[model samples]
Target: MACVYSMRSSLFWMMLVSLTGLAITGCATSVSTTTDKPRLAQQSVLSTLWMDRAGEYRALCHQAFNMAKLQVDRRLSYHRTLEKPLAVIVDIDETVLSNVPYFSQLIDKGEVFPRGWKVWMQMSTAQAIPGALEFLKYARFRGVEVFYISNRSINEGLTATINNLVKMDFPFADQRHLLLKSKSGNKQPRRDRVEQTHEVILLIGDNLNDFSLIFSDKPVVQRNNAVDMMSSEFGKRFIILPNPIYGDWEGALYDYQWGTSSAQKLKVRQQLYNQ
Candidate 1:
């Protein structure tokens, strides 16, 4: 019965294609193709699953925040008489909140970024990452302020992002504490803004860009070289989380060329294998 139904569906699609002389979107679901968006979504399946299901992912998140807590404590003990109040600036997506589910939805639908991202943000359903809430709340209890500086658009994602954080009971979820992207994804300006009044003792994020604008727009080799140069700061002043699904690291592989075709991307990935 299943075989018969499959055959009938295939025949219907064939007839429709013949009549219209144009291929319908997603009509060849079973056929393997190097179509960019769907292929990229397929590539993300494993990373998304790891983030959503693996206990290791949770442990890594906890490990990051644990180190953050220790650093904050150490800084507080050493700098008791600082003029500016202490603050921890954190990135929002995948740092404070787990958007694994959003990526999962995109994977299921063979979609990618900036497609349903705004809609997902507006849903305000993102959950706090493991240990994020506890650590931020601890910071607040210790008289330190927490600031959210994210690349999420201020216009499209402000209200929903705040709502999501507030719903999750994140510390300092208000307008004054949250800073969204205005004209650029470079978060250095936002970090500078935070530094205007508060002593930013710690910077936490999944991406290096969250720490400094130096990591922004760099190619793969330069980015790696920058990381090596800044090795001492990784677990100390910077709390780095795990996010394998998507990042600038991936973008750097294509030399930050956003216009590359899907098939070309696949070729590049294949060429870079084991290199």
Candidate 2:
């Protein structure tokens, strides 16, 4: 479904307009201007997916998975992974299951997140990314253990997340394979947990933090530097699904402060874009 420009109410925009000269508030803001949508910080996120790029998005998924398949082949050819059960660590949202519906609802219905989020998950209708299921199943068929590590908290929507996964016919779709965030957002701990049993051949997600702590909780520039340092590993050991909507990339622009108002954040982003 197409998104219906779901930003906050008009009064909020007026208040933000009034704050044009106000310094950054107690709540941090992002340089990425998606806060209130002069279109989502990255307009391409919605426009590309909701418009002409639907096929391109699917093609990217297929290509990423294809690259992953080749990597798996390379690993199989190498004897190092044979010593332990092989596995791939993946993030749940956006990477495997597309959550564009919730995003669309926000734009169309003007309903904010954590409001209709649970209801959306409860519906259990998140379609799998174009090539995710096939690649995951292929990994399973080759005896690779798949671990789904997501920041979707247990207290928030874990049950429905699991149900959605199982409903979508994802392999290893059970409590054993599904992991919801409990302790921290740092997925390295969960990756370590998986590595305790199997060699994690690949770490997949739409966010940079999904792969390593280097990108976790860091500033925007630092995260980019870390990505540059590990450039060689991206396609080979870390498969990143495209998610221009929201992630650490956007969060970093706000300096990781969660309390920033949409209006304030948008102002900050606008400044960045103008620069």
Which numbered prediction scores highest in TM-score against the true structure?
1
Off by over 4 Å in 2: 1-53, 80-82
lDDT of 2 by residue, 1-275 (tens): 12333344566777887696454543454443334543442443454355224787778888999999888888888756449889998898888998886776666644345567777877878888878999999999888889999988778677788888888888998888977889787788888888998888998899998898878889878898999999999999999988776788888988998777666666778789998
Per-prediction TM-score to the true structure, in the order listed: 0.85, 0.82
Candidate 1: where is the Cα deviation over 4 Å? 1-34
C-alpha lDDT score of every prediction, in listed order: 0.89, 0.79
> Cα deviation of 45 in candidate 2 (Å)?
7.5
Instruction: Single out the weakest 10-residue window by summed lDDT for candidate 2.
Output: 1-10
Candidate 1, residue 44: the lDDT equals 88
lDDT string for model 1 (55-98, tens) is 99999999999999999899888776648999999999999999
